[model samples]
Target: MGIKVVKRHGSSFKDKLYLPAIAGGMKTTLKHFIKNLKDVDNLKTMQYPEVQPDDLNERYRGVHRLTKWEDESEKCVACYMCATACPAECIFIEAEERFDEKAEKRPKEFKIDLLECVFCGYCVEACPCDAIRMDTGIFSFTGDKREDFVLDKKALMKNERSKDLDND
Candidate 1:
């Protein structure tokens, strides 16, 4: 037996009219090209670093940041909740017991590697004490070395949104 191929229907009127459809598409393309060529400056493109868009909203997750007080004191209670909740496992924290005339457990070291972070915002959401925050509004983070992206307590606290924990 011989293999066979069959077509039940012949080409339709629309199939025969492909050239006009192609011409119509080209016309639309040309119209856009002419319009863009005439007003190239009006194109929707921004010169980054030189010009940037305003902050989108409070919910915009850009960078990972740990909170501090006005006195440059660490706001994190070192509950390990943020670290546990972090999907990327980018957060590192070490809690220590301290006495402020009253004994309390607080974080001695808190670090977040922004390079490894996915900006999921789970840390901020999981914080029960509102100890951590990502309200710096300074979203852009770049550095040459891998260690540079590891944001420590000092760097995170320096953000404008963070208060001075030490003085407070």
Candidate 2:
């Protein structure tokens, strides 16, 4: 059977004039402007850098960081799970056979292109050894060069939030 579509009639006189809509928008703008002007302190905006918001949620997924073992060794076994799960393909890892018998493999070169990362937390979830996490509380990053955005193993290890591991 064919579908039947019903079309609505033309706009009313007020809708055609568009004056009522314009007036409504102006009224809202004026109301907010006056209210804000009267009590400037009531404004929700913060003087960032100097005054940061205190209410950062506990579950806020900030930036990626590699975890370290108790002996200060990299915990990642370099299974490529994180890289596989990364939708943006920002995670890059190179596995190498470990010299130590205890650990079979280790990451020779682990890198994450922050510029391409979507911060979906999939990498964190895919990690089997609890090696990767996004709990640095560092959402903002700036750099002069493109290479600066690529987080190497050293940088990832340095950025580790130990407190986040403790919480886990």
Candidate 3:
């Protein structure tokens, strides 16, 4: 025969149930609500577009910009360092050899899928020639299809960062 276990229960006697915890939470909410009500003039619940942040870092990795040297030459030898270092793997680059002795190679087709980008700024750190940068401070990205987020050379070059980049 198998052994059986007995169950247990407490007699019905009640103190205040969870009233202190509830009161504490309510107190916190009321404190913040009253403070905001007192300082309605100082509160900035809205005021977008009218006020923005700052600009890019000296080395901010925003939208990629192919760097130009002092001689008006492209700095990128198309070594693919930026693509390899990108954590998001958003950077796609194709290199082509240059006939000119001064300019050895340039990107045949460089594309960055902003959709996949985490904005971690790894690509900017990996560039040997400073060919790519994420200077645009804009953080909002919206798209309906895969193609919409794929930022080509033209879009990256022209896409300007808002002033918010300087905030951080």
- Top candidate, metric TM-score: 2
lDDT of 1: 0.76
The whole-model C-alpha lDDT of candidate 2 against the native structure comes to 0.88
Q: In candidate 2, which residue pairs clash?
A: none
Give the runs in model 3 whose Cα sits over 4 Å from its true position: 1-22, 44-46, 54-61, 69-74, 141-144, 160-168
* Candidate 2 lDDT score at position 105: 98
- Candidate 2 per-residue lDDT, tens place, 75-145, comes to 99999999999999999999999886558999999999999999999999999999998888886789999
Clashing pairs in 3: 53-163, 54-163, 54-166, 61-134, 62-133, 62-134, 62-135, 63-134, 136-161
Poorest 10 consecutive residues by lDDT, candidate 3: 7-16
- Write one digit per residue (lDDT tens) for candidate 3, span 100-151: 7756788777788877888787777888767666666554567899998887
Score every model by TM-score.
0.71, 0.82, 0.67
Q: Sum up the clashes in candidate 2.
A: 0
What ordering of candidates by lDDT runs from best to worst? Answer: 2, 1, 3
- Give the C-alpha lDDT of model 3: 0.71
Question: What ranking of all candidate models by TM-score puts the best one first?
Answer: 2, 1, 3
lDDT string, candidate 1, 35-103, tens digits: 999998999877898986674566666655666556656667778999999999999998899665322
How much does each candidate deviate from the true structure in C-alpha RMSD?
Answer: 6.8, 3.1, 6.2
